[model samples]
Target: MSRKKRIAIIGTAGIPARYGGFETLAEQLVRQLGDKYAITVYCPGPKYTKEERKTSFQSARLKYLPLQANGLQSIPYDSLSILHALFSADVLLVLGVAGAWLLPFVKLFTRKKIIVSIDGIEWKRAKWNRLAKCYLWWAEKMAVKYSHADISDNESIQDYTAVRYTSLSHIIEYGADHTVQVTPTAKDKEEYPFLHKPYAFKVCRIEPENNIHLVLEAFATMPGYTLVMIGNWKNSEYGSSLYLQYSGYNNIILMDPVYDQRKLDVIRGNAYLYVHGHSAGGTNPSLVEAMYLGLPVLAFDVSYNRTTTEGKACYFKTAADIAAIIGNTRLAVLRENGFRMKEIAHRRYTWEVVARKYDELVQRVLNNKGKIPVTPSVATIPAEQLISYELAHLQAPTPFYEKR
Candidate 1:
């Protein structure tokens, strides 16, 4: 009998993911792969209580650290977790670029396999200051350069890495199977009166990059259309001001973050349409979850969102675009969009598929086979030639070559 491989999952807040994408990914990976691998997960003490911090979760061991898993402290937290795992684990499955500065040393000194997921292009996020963004940018380079395998959650991110780092990043998007299509109970309707009405729903961090202001402005302009947006309204001054400004609107219901899974699902699943304002990040978990709930998405017009939805959903670039779509789009079109979105979600965004990809990548890394070849950063051929030859569906030349 062969011994099971030892794996360490680092960079998440904790198990029983209370928030965010990486945490949820970590949780799902553990649940699916626990039996096959001897997994040890690092939990940040700030996020989990002493009572909640048992020695183990599911079949995996939990190691608690006395620091926050996010922000500046995550650097130390992830570094310490990596150092501790170096002694015991065969593979270090790191979820973010927070402690990527230590990866070069880990790769140089230890035999442990380092697999990293650069959680979207973190440096591009509007929340981070210039200094923080610089550090993140550097860390991202280090993580990609040093890791045995790198992951990108969306094809757009993969394209970015392929062009920037000349690295072949495994595309493993977040699973949406965890999200259920919930019917509002009488109690649910009593608790959330907005459940009874036809409204567009959105739930995300109230950040500048997410375009919360744009969504609010769009809904505000059209009094007939209702918008139910849930987020951490008091987390920042921007969020606070937005809440104050929009909460008074009869059509726009600005609610605080709702962590309860079923409660959130019921509200989201019952919506007439799901509006995704996020302009950053790759394959947002919330967006995919909405697709799983059979909701038509009105996503921000961006390559990342387009890639995630496979260009099947509606898109908006501005407040007016969103407002016009809501006002003009027929219910039948919305239903068709929802069905197509659901089909895409069912085929691509399931945990079983995601876990299988991870498992394959891990095995390939451990075996020292299927290593990504070093490719030149620059393309040899012009964009016009490549598109003309590769894209058979394009009847006319691409807009870039149309003028030529």
Candidate 2:
């Protein structure tokens, strides 16, 4: 048999997927594609201690670098990974735009194919400073332009990139199959008394863009509706202050990040409703995992969230909107919505489906020469010719999207 193609995964916080979406995606990719390809994953050395670190994970080779995989350090972390992967890997699968500044050089200097997944519109987030935002904005541009192929996790993001860069971005969303519907144990219920009651649940990073305060404020007004929210409460000043303000309310339970998957799933999967306050990012893993557990979602009214749930789940723009939605929505209607969400998740969000898409992209990039735009073939035809054929509508430059 011929040798398998070598693949390098970069820009994640290291696998075994303890962190967030990108790391989960990397783990799933390795699990799904390891047999078909010779895979190597670049990991953050600082996260794993010498005793915890292994030379290999699953069937993929693991290479660790002494740098953090996020924040300002991510630039050098990802850059070094890319430079090292260039020597042996057949394709470089980068998960973010952090190291994108080096892509143009890679494109010009090397024959290796680069596939980048811009992890949402990072620069648009409220947490980033002006300088970080500026750099990320420029880096996102570079990643889209220089990479052989680019992936978008949501349709709205795909539309954004198509309009901005005039390139077709492959839509490959996160999988929720790893998140199981856990039946809370006696100990679980003892620790989380909210398990006995019909409560709304939410889990995400404690960031301004997530609209955590808005969700808390909404729940605070409706004392009857209990809301249990889990996040990194001490990670920032904003999070700490919110925790102080909201924790006093008997109806709202503010807790720190729950890294234990089983415990987290016990609380999350049993909730009557999933409140998604995120106003940024595309196809959030937390939201999809909730859907997979057949939980009805009350999400922030944004294009990304709307597209992810296919407009089937209820949405809210403000604290009043959230309170109004929860107050008026009946349990029967919520149950039906939960069914629809589970159906959508089963059909669209699974590791098998996501992995197959990545494999297909790898195959296509290996054979293809350059990026292709989403612009219709008819757009290439002259205006006079289109007028003659009475196909002017087909040649229109704008793509129609549902107003958010």
Question: TM-score, each model?
Answer: 0.92, 0.97
| Predicted candidate 2 versus true structure: per-residue lDDT over 1-404, tens digit per residue | 58999999999999888979999999999999999999999999999999888988899999999999999999999999999999979999999999999999999999999999999999998788999999999999999999999999999998899889988899999999999889988998899888998999999999998999999999999999999999999989999999999899999998888899999999999999999999989999999999999999999999999999999999999999999999999999999999999999998999999999999999999997578767767788999898898887777756543244
Number of clashes recorded per candidate: 0, 0
Could you say which candidate leads in lDDT?
Answer: 2
Clashing residue pairs found in predicted model 2: none
Error of 2 at 275 (Å): 0.2
Q: Show the lowest summed lDDT stretch of 10 residues, model 1.
A: 395-404
Cα lDDT of model 1 by residue, 1-404, tens digit: 49899999999989888898888888898899998999999999977766877888889898999999989999999999999999989999999999999999988988899999999899988778999999999999999999999999998888788778766888999899999888888999999998888999999998999999999999999999899999998999999999888899999998888989989999999998999999989999999999988899999999999999999999999999999999999999999999999999999999999999999989988997644643532244566776778843443333221223
* lDDT assessment of candidate 1: 0.90
**Relative to the true structure, how large is the alpha-carbon lDDT of every model?**
0.90, 0.93
